[model samples]
Target: MFELNDLRQTRFYQDVFAEGKQKGRQEGKLETIPQLLALGLSIQQIAQALGLDEQLVKQAAQPKS
Candidate 1:
């Protein structure tokens, strides 16, 4: 029987887990932009610190439409 534990042991599962982890980390960084801005950090500074593109930082700072 292919149990949850068995599924978790597969290469595909591992790859997906890694991808999700990276995405989560990226989202966490994006989420922090507001706080950083409130702390008086410029968009350029945030982009450099987070290793993100300046355009991405600018997009994150904008209010969601």
Candidate 2:
């Protein structure tokens, strides 16, 4: 029983860590949109290169408050 509980906890933490890593990668991609645009890439091109939606790329290109 103790071993099973430990294994569940470990799996839960591993899943959380994986999700965090994915989120970090997505944020990093969003951060790069401006630079890619500056380099003369269109919204569609940036989205294709980043494997993201064109709307997401356009949203990221918007100025922050």
Candidate 3:
């Protein structure tokens, strides 16, 4: 039977874990865009600081429509 430790050692599990971490980090960065904007940072500055694309930052800045 597969144990919890065995599952963690599998390639698929590792890949999924890594992907989740990356996605979480990206979401966190995108969520921060508004607060940074409130603090007077430009889209370019936010993109440079967050290591994200200017387009992504701009999209994040857009109103929900």
Per-residue CA lDDT of model 2 for 11-37, tens digit only, reads 787898799999999999999999999
RMSD of each: 1.1, 3.2, 0.7
Q: Quote the positional error of residue 49 for candidate 2 in Å.
A: 0.3
Error of 3 at 46 (Å): 0.2
- Model 2 is weakest, by summed lDDT over 10 consecutive residues, at 1-10
Among residues 3 or more apart in sequence or in different chains, the pairs in candidate 1 whose N, CA or C atoms overlap within 3 Å are none
Residue pairs that clash (backbone atoms under 3 angstroms), model 2: none
Give the Å shift of residue 23 in candidate 1. Answer: 0.8
On a 0 to 100 scale, what is the lDDT of residue 53 in model 3? 100
Question: What digit string (tens of lDDT, one per residue) describes model 1 on residues 1-65?
Answer: 88999999999999999999999999999999999999999999999999999999999999888
Q: For candidate 2, what is the lDDT?
A: 0.93
List, residue by residue over 1-65, the lDDT tens digit for candidate 3.
98999999999999999999999999999999999999999999999999999999999999778
- In model 2, the runs with Cα more than 4 Å from the true position are 1-9
Which is the leading candidate under TM-score?
3
Ranked by TM-score, top first: 3, 1, 2
Whose TM-score is higher: candidate 1's or candidate 2's?
1
Greater TM-score among 2 and 3 belongs to 3
